[model samples]
Target: MEDNVKELIEITALVIEVIGILVLVFGTFLAMGRYAFKLQGEDIRSFQKIREEIGRSILLGLEILIAADIIATVVYDAQMEQILKLGLIILIRTFLSFTLEIEIEGKLPWKQEKHRTTGKK
Candidate 1:
């Protein structure tokens, strides 16, 4: 890779990773703040909503981090070991995202009939 392009890719990856981290932190605090405010005079049942929001943020953040990893790995390393490590990292993140999705929605994506607008089963 050209030196300039390599530097740009590295910086882009770093920025993406930072954005991912920020999303997780900001989302968690936002959800917590809302939940706390609701506790004062609102329904406590909103806990589930808050939990889902947090999980969604985590999922989004994980995906963003994965994108950053891909970009960095492609630009900075091509060794078999690095590729394997990237694959493992992606696998772990994907599993985490999958579980979070299930936890938040209480169902698999394909099984979400209610979440669909056409109401088709």
Candidate 2:
């Protein structure tokens, strides 16, 4: 029973990681298509919008990958070394997410929507 549970968790984590990779790849193609369309239409802000969309997709993919890492490390193999590695991975991904959010939104994640809605900063 215990081994079955571990196998299930490992499979789940692998599935999540695969999904993340798919999202990242799909999003890249989508962004590329949009960029090409915008370029043909001579839109001045095409690159900016494309960059923002790509960044958003990457951030989302990173989050999903982080989830997979957590599941693999914590649920499938709860060794101290694995946990520490997971922590470092999570930390780096989190920082990347933060930077991407700022780059795409021009504000911090917590502040972006709030400031837009409230007009306070």
Candidate 3:
């Protein structure tokens, strides 16, 4: 029973990672195609829109990947060293996510909704 649970967790983590990769790739392709179609008319804003769309997709993919890493490490691994490594990985990914969010939105994640609602940057 214990082994079965471990195997299930490992599989689940793998599936999550795969899904993240698929989302990232699909989002990129969709954004590029959409922008390309729009660019036929020489729209200057298309580039910015594409970049924002791609950034959002990447942020989501990174979050999903982080969750997969946590599940694989925390649920299946029993070693303290592995857990510490997982912590570092999660920290780095989180920082990257924050940076990406700021880059894409021109504001911090927490401030984004407020800025949108207030129409203030």
Best by TM-score: 1
Clash number for each model:
0, 0, 0
Residue runs of model 3 more than 4 Å from their true location after superposition: 39-44, 113-121
- Locate the minimum summed-lDDT window of 10 residues in model 2: 37-46
Screening candidate 2 with a backbone cut-off below 3 angstroms (N, C-alpha, C), the clashing residue pairs are none
lDDT preference between candidates 2 and 3, better one? 3
Q: How well does model 3 score by local distance difference test? A: 0.85
Q: Model 3: what TM-score? A: 0.82
Local lDDT at 70 for model 2: 81
C-alpha displacement of 34 in model 1, angstroms?
0.2
lDDT of 1: 0.87
Can you list the residue pairs that collide in candidate 3? none
- lDDT for 33 in candidate 2 is 92
lDDT of 1 by residue, 1-121 (tens): 5988999999999999999999999989988897888752344478777888799899999999999988898585678898888899989999999999899888897886753777667
TM for every model, in the order presented, reads 0.85, 0.84, 0.82
Clashes of 3: 0
lDDT tens digits by residue: candidate 3, 1-121: 9888888999999999999899899989988998878852455477788988899899999999998998898474578887788889889989988999999879766764536576775
